[model samples]
Target: MRVMGIDPGTVVVGYGVIDSDAGRETMIAYGVLTASVKEKPAQRLSILYKSLEKIVLKFKPDAVAVETPFVSQNVSSALAIGRAQAVALLAATNRGIPTFEYSPAQVKQRVASYGASSKEQIQQMVKMQLGLSEIPKPSDAADALAVALCHLSEVHVSGLLGEQTPKRKRRSV
Candidate 1:
């Protein structure tokens, strides 16, 4: 399965694409989309939408997994991030791709084996898991890859459960 992971932001949105099969993950692409400060908020959002759309078209991912916003001391920052995340979701939805949201703690736990893992630790794990020569730059890109990895793991678990379970009739509740 091919998955696109997004780490959304107004100024710089990070993205990563990976292909997974039989419990192995291979990196396809990873990068950031930057919006200039001089641009208006609406323009920035437009840019983000278009950039994300192009990525979707290019990668043709089966699903998109995004990191959800965590509460921040600065309300405005959180709000902006929320808006960017909305745009990211819309882009994927418009393309008819399934989207899944994961919290930062989930992403950290999946990628680093600890919910409170540091950015450096996440980067290291992402690098090692993907067999990259070095850590992905800008931190956000690494986080995006981590989100994809988390979804891939989820997919594997779901498959295993499906194989172990037998089909049963549902009773009216």
Candidate 2:
């Protein structure tokens, strides 16, 4: 399966694409979509949407996994992240891809075997899982890869249990 994972943010959205087959995961591409602070909020969103569309077009992922926004003390920041996530989802949906959202804790636990694993630990694990020599640059990109790995693991387990589809929560707009 080819999967594209997204770590969405207004200023810097990270993405990772990977192909998994026969219990082996291979990294295809990983990078961040950076938006300038000088741009207006709407303009930043436009940039994010365009960058994500380009990725989806280039990779043609079968599935998209995205990190869900965690609750934050800063409501405005959370809102901005939510908006960015929405755009990311829309980009995938427009291309007929099935999108899955995972929480940060779930991603950490799946990738590192600990929900409380630090960012460094997650990055190391992602590198180790894919047998990469170096950690993926831009922490957010690594995080996105972790999200995709988590979904792949979940799907594998589900298949073992003879399930065709994994449980997913529908996001209400």
Candidate 3:
């Protein structure tokens, strides 16, 4: 299965593509899509959406796993990130691809075996799991990979147990 994981931000959206086969995961590509803060909000969002759409069209991932925006004390900031998350999700849904969402803690726990694992720990685990010699550049990209791997792990575990993983609700975001 090919999975595209996304860590969304208004200014920078992180993405990683991975191929998982029989429990083995391999990194296919990873990068960040950046939008200038100087640009108008609508323009920045357009940039994000177009870049992400290209990724989806090119990779044609079987599933897309995206990190949910963390609730923040700053409501505006949280909302902005949420918009970015929506943009990523829209790209997948428009292509008729299945999409899933994972919380940051869930991603850390699934990838590093500890919910409280540090960012560096998650990055190291991503590198190890994908057999990359060096950690993926740009921490956000590594985080995206973790989200993808987390979803794959969940799917594998559920299949092993002869159970179905709960589906995430889709929103217009």
Displacement of residue 46 (Cα, Å) in model 2 is 0.9
TM-score for every candidate vs. truth?
Answer: 0.91, 0.95, 0.94
How do the residues 74-164 of candidate 3 rate in per-residue lDDT, one tens digit apiece?
8898899989998999999999988888889989989999999999999999999999999999998999999999989888877888876
Ranking by TM-score: 2, 3, 1
Taken over the whole model, the C-alpha lDDT of each candidate is 0.86, 0.90, 0.90
Q: Which pairs of residues have clashing backbones in candidate 1?
A: none
Query: What does candidate 1's lDDT look like per residue over 1-173, in tens digits?
Result: 89999999988999999999777899999999989989999899999999999999999998888888888698888888989988888888898888888888988988888999998888899999999999998788988999998878767666788742112210111
Once superposed on the true structure, which residue ranges of model 2 sit more than 4 Å away at CA?
Answer: 169-173
Q: Point out the worst 10-residue segment of candidate 1 by lDDT.
A: 164-173
Candidate 1, position 23, lDDT: 79
Model 1 CA deviation exceeding 4 Å by range: 163-173
Colliding residue pairs in candidate 2: none
